[model samples]
Target: RVFDVLVEGQLAIPALDLALEAGTYTAVSRQYTVKVSDGQLNVRFATRQGATLVNGVRVSERPDKALP
Candidate 1:
């Protein structure tokens, strides 16, 4: 699950800490890679699934602010 993401001018997240704790493995960190490409920016998403919270705090909102 993506807890948070931030991009600038439609950039990419070079490095992010990700983990999988399913049947795939008890736990694994930084074993995945994320890629960002153009022509498909500002993709719209629905909130019909309601809100996703982490540690009792909301964090499902997609990033919209530009990074320097």
Candidate 2:
């Protein structure tokens, strides 16, 4: 399955609850979207000083075992 996310013309991530299953990912700088497939958990992110961190890591798509 595939999911399409659009940040539209906004420059911030939307505040909502989500759950990912496994699929694909697509994001934009400052404003973007992500997609995941079934059985894959949706990863959350936080921006600090223009840097993106997934589960406190400096990169995205980390090992599933490395997740909390």
Candidate 3:
């Protein structure tokens, strides 16, 4: 499946395809940095090709070890 990830209504990921990147049935981890000005974090996935599939999502405070 292919889709676009939008953070704060802005395009973050143009097209994400798990099958192409990690193959079927494989787990992949992705991280994105976004600043929430309205105190709300909105994550939306817009379908580009097929259906959108997401196993999980994690949100946390900016970690010093994580790159921006």
Candidate 4:
């Protein structure tokens, strides 16, 4: 399945296919840097091909190391 993710109403992840990147039932992760103007953080997922599914979501401060 494929989908798009939006954070704070802006596009963050586009055309994500979990089964193609990682095998079914495997874990895959993606991280993005976004500034929170408001106290709330919104994450929205839209299906591109099939139904979109998410296992979990995590929110934390940016790490010292930069993302590769």
Model 3, residue 6: C-alpha shift (Å): 0.5
Total clashing pairs in model 2: 7
Q: Tell me each candidate's TM-score.
A: 0.17, 0.18, 0.84, 0.82
lDDT of 2 by residue, 1-68 (tens): 22232232232344322223322353323322333445453444433333442322232464563424
* Candidate 3 residue lDDT tens string, 1-68: 89999999999989988899889999888877877888889999999998887888989988673545
Per-residue lDDT of 5-53 in model 1, one digit per residue for the tens? 3332432432223433343224432222223455333422222233422
Query: Considering every candidate listed, which one attains the maximal TM-score?
Result: 3
Output the better candidate (1/2) by lDDT.
Answer: 2
lDDT of 4 at 36: 70
User: CA lDDT of each candidate?
Assistant: 0.32, 0.34, 0.87, 0.86
Ranking by lDDT: 3, 4, 2, 1
Ten residues in sequence with the least summed lDDT for candidate 3: 59-68
Q: What lDDT score is found at residue 27 in candidate 2?
A: 32
The reply for model 4, stretches above 4 Å from the true place, is: 63-68
Q: Clashes per prediction?
A: 0, 7, 0, 0
lDDT of 4 by residue, 1-68 (tens): 89999999998889988899888999987777887778788999999998999989999976653444
